[model samples]
Target chain A: MKKKKMIISSQTMELDVVRKVEALSGTSVRRCFQCGKCSAGCPMATFMEHPPNRIVRLLQLGQWQRILAGRSIWYCASCETCSTRCPNKVHLASIMDALRKLSWDAEGPSKESYVQLANRLFLENIRSYGRQYEMRLAAVFNVKSGQFLKDLMLGPKLISKGKLKMFHQKNRNMAEIEKIFSRIEEMRKKGEAL
Target chain B: MDKTLNYAYYPGCSLHASAGEYDLSTRELFNLLGVGLTEVPDWFCCGATPAHNVDELLSLSLCAKNLELAEQVDGDVAVACAACFSRLKFTQHTLLEDETKRRQVEKAIDAPARLDGKVKHLLEILARDIGLERLASAVSKPLSGVKVACYYGCLLTRPPDVPNLDCVEAPTIMERVVEAAGAETVPWSHRMECCGANFTLSRPGVVIQLSNAILDSAKSSGADCVVVACPLCHGNLDMRQKEIEGVYNAEYGLPVFYITQLLAVACGAGAEKSGLGALMVDPFPLLKVKNIL
Candidate 1:
């Protein structure tokens, strides 16, 4: 892992995109003055290349590409510890969400696919069954991620304990749930909602 | 305390399947405590962490839709899962503060976003609505010798002014509720820490490491069991306890009990009624030793 030297200039800086992030998260990236409080409290900071405060600093410098390319935003557990502990009220958790959303919309160059895959399947489960089927979610996640034997040993024990259900009961209001999804899609298409 | 408290129950997705015991214990405990909980009819998922992780509009709309459904039969909306509780409260908070987002969510749901309905986690219901004094009176079998580490995890109280359930930094709702049931709570360090949440499915290695730290903290604190409100926390702590132990090469056989499960058991519900057998780590040994069962 070679360190890429950061070059800050008008060409490299994408302030417009940073503004979009600020708009989406409804928080200012400028407020984070490298306080390091967010990174200190973040549980997943060890797993991230750039910690929460650094992510905000990157956003402030319009270096979101670097933040998104790495696995920092993906590794965030969204524990809201950063948001809760921020002395500057930066709302780092929501900023992480905004970055993830933008990266997802771009079909991201992120190296972390397992987390994105799991999130996709979770949202798909909701849209399809109007609720989450944990058994199906885990099974499909295992299959898609090519980790077929992942959690295989825990399956029988969970079933024996009646923790995992074989069949999920679909919500009776599936039509309404579908409508909500479709309406949101329509709103996004018309640029009526972010 | 004499007044009958009724609420429209939103069990969330986990409650129906993997966290069935939590749902069972909630119903049984609420019944015994005389708190009326009617299931919100055909409630869809509140979009939990995933929806909000990517699409805030979808998350707000999903929770807003559920809030509308909850208005059908309710005093206030009662939520079991901490994630669901957080999302619902967030939707209400966001919609109230930002009129533009509220209008968009209403359009997405094709109904007015109902921000007026009170969204409460089960802890608030037990501690405030039903009152802890009455909870203590209802305990038939006092868990006199059982030591508990009440794990709040995340989402219960964090980021301040959102859930408003208790003090965001140092919440004692779980400890207070468990103590009311005659269980002693240990002053552990990792009670408010994250349990790697949904990563139990995505990045299990992370869950193992984080949950191991939590388990180690509880075990070192001289706790017999870890009590939790969130099902995901329970899963990471209980379902993966053995795996975590193997990964860390340490032994921590602490049983993780949902708050409702422990409360129901203390309130005279049998093992079957409380769904104690659903737990992966055997809690019977501790219960029997404490003479609670």
Candidate 2:
């Protein structure tokens, strides 16, 4: 890869943004040389508005809004294909994760999409049951996302096969699970990244 | 090798719900093999896919709590679900590699993270712990002439270092296991392909597209059926095969079997005990044809 000739300027590099992404992901955006390996191996790249390579390029240029405005961040499935295939060892999956965390917080009420909605419902389910209660998660998600009847047809079949349980099962250490969440929330309130 | 080996089995949420068959088959297969698997007492979820993507600390902490529980058991944690395997291994990797994150997870779980070899997928136990030779000798009803496509899916071998079991891009552990049971595994390109597991619930179309491609690859390779270790992959490829055909406007009548189910069948256990009755894709006709039912 050849470096592009450009004059260096303080305004050209968003040092704080770069450092923040690095701190959270522990992967340097500067390590990416636009090799496109990450995007090349990404299965969901076609569905994404901006491919992972372009997102990394945007990150390198410190164009936070340009990267976040697109739905690409939400499209990542985090399969780790890119992370495994990267010769630069960039861990694009983790970077995508960091970006999603940032973008999710920045999302407005009207900005909710299916992936975002599912993610919120998923965490909420985990927070409550300590494990994914599939039927409950789906029903609550359907109610919240206003897709009440979505996947309704599949429920009875799943139930008949004993795949979906009617009653919720809680972990033995529900108090411990609750404490873990509270500890993380308490840390977040104190300005922690995670 | 010891006649009997023990493991702290950590069947994740799916085992109690959607993947009950997998849990049943795993226990049955292990029982016939003289392998003792003790379920970790009161084990919580391993934080699977969503937790890591949402909060790194919460993900690590969730996995750490399970690891702490497994530490009280006899052996390294043995998991059947690929997602739980990946998350738990990744948690151990993270807690070992980064001290600050380790401290954070330590604080969250109220337990010290033991990164010293406490997590392993069931495949590792079969292929490495219990030698393939032993498994082969134990097989009474060999699935001879049965052409199978061993699907590794994504999480079991990807990211190279997490589970760190087989070749990342092209895994062969599943093939070796099934092959030892006298089944012939066809060489296929989509072994480690992503089954769009995360999109199974939210976006059915994507799952259909990706899973169809995998099914197509397996079919073109002349596979009689498909074998999988991941519950979500099995769910997408088997439970939704009809919908997948509808979406792609093509037919792929592949019977997806959990590796343990097939292993149990090979080990002389009845199909019912292997949970074959619970499968969406009917394997009875095919198994009867092969005289392995």
Candidate 3:
């Protein structure tokens, strides 16, 4: 394996990009000392292309494009292990969250589209019914993501036990929820509806 | 009458669907305990794990709505799912601490940012408010000699400062509650571990591997069954137990129970009301052998 080093270079380091990540996450990136505690405790780090600490290091080096396009952000389940384990309180989970949003905005299409699809379906269920429609969330996510039959066998088994309700339980506060989504649109500073 | 205890119940998405067992057992157990639980009318989703992965404002807005709804009622809000409990309590902590973030969330939800109501997990209710002594006395069936591994999973007590529900590193709230039900909680390192939550769907392979680790620990620790406070953890550990066994080429006959389900049975609600039938990995065989079923 070839050796790689993190040498500080003014030409490669973009402080503004790091500042943007700090601002978006509302967490102090400056507090991280490369201690790797966040990466150590992360359960998803093994599956990630870049560990949480690596992403944080990239952010420190202003590699916004690299981090945004990476699968590390999409894989983070936001278990908060990294956030809680960090001695500096870096809140790596929040930074990973910011990166996920940025990935959707900048990267166009993600290989983790099934996950992205599910997130949208989750929100859409809430937007329409005032609460998450779990059955429909799966149906929509499967169909839209082209991952049909994902839980094909398990679905019937769960339904048989009455675990997955077929009928939707629409909350009476549907209009109120709609108003909130709309108001959020007006309040958004990111200028992106999604 | 004025002294009657009450709690506003917020059964999140899973409780209504996948984790109906958790909901059923919670209500059934609480009913047996004589604690009044009223549903938080028209409560919405807390966005769970996925929402935060997408957008911050979206995540905060969804949780804030439920918090606002809870404000309409009187006493503290009670929840069965750990994810919901964490989201509700975490949002409250974040909003109360950061004025700018609070304002943004309020603007996003179009609701005032005041979590006047206390959001608590069911374990907290059993451990703190009801007290272990009261819980122990209420147990009529006494899950006698049942070895339980009370899995807190990820959310129930992480991000130490935010929830502050118990000792973050070594939370025993679940264990304390299980002990009250006459079950011996096995000491294990995987109690506070992550079970790949929503990734159970997005990344099934990852879920299987991670869940196997938890199951391995529970088995090695001599636990007869695994218990959880989160529906996602239950789904991964219980629903995907077979897949985990197949992947790792091992058998984990351990039945995963919601903490509430264990309490429901111990309090004499019977297995019928405990939702034991809904479990993907059957706990009945073990329960029958132990005379708990």
Local distance difference test, candidate 2: 0.84
- Please give the distance, in angstroms, between residue B256's alpha carbon in candidate 1 and its true position after superposition: 0.8
Q: What would the per-residue lDDT of candidate 3 be over residues B2-67, giving only the tens digit for each residue? A: 246789899987888888888899889888888888898888878787777776777788888888
Residue A34 in candidate 3, Cα distance off native in Å: 0.5
Cα lDDT tens digits for candidate 1, B245-272 = 8988999989999999999999999899
**Candidate 2 falls in which docking quality class?**
medium
In candidate 1, which residue pairs clash?
Answer: none
Q: Rank the candidates by DockQ, best first.
A: 1, 2, 3
Off by over 4 Å in 3: A1-12, A107-109, A189-194
Checking candidate 3 for backbone clashes, the offending pairs are: none
The prediction achieving the highest DockQ against the true structure is 1
**Candidate 3 on A1-194: residue-level lDDT in tens?**
67898677655778776666677787988688999998899898898888998898887787767776666788887888999989888888888877787776574345666677767777788788877677887777778877898879888888998888898878887887788777777766465333
What are the runs in model 2 whose C-alpha is more than 4 Å off? Answer: A1-10, A108-112, A192-194, B1-4
List the lowest-lDDT window of 10 residues for candidate 3 chain B.
Answer: B1-10
Which has the better lDDT: candidate 2, or candidate 3?
Answer: 2
* Residue B96 displacement (Å), model 2: 1.2
**TM-score-based ranking:** 1, 2, 3
Per-residue CA lDDT of candidate 2, range B1-293, in tens?
A: 24358989999999988888999999999999999899999888877777777577788888888888888888778999999999998888877888888988887877778778567889989999998999999999999989999999889988977779898887778888898899999999888778889777677677888889999999899998999999989898888887877777887778899999999999988988899988888899889999997
Candidate 1 Cα misplacement greater than 4 A, ranges? A1-13, B1-3
What is the alpha-carbon interface RMSD for each candidate? 0.7, 1.3, 2.2
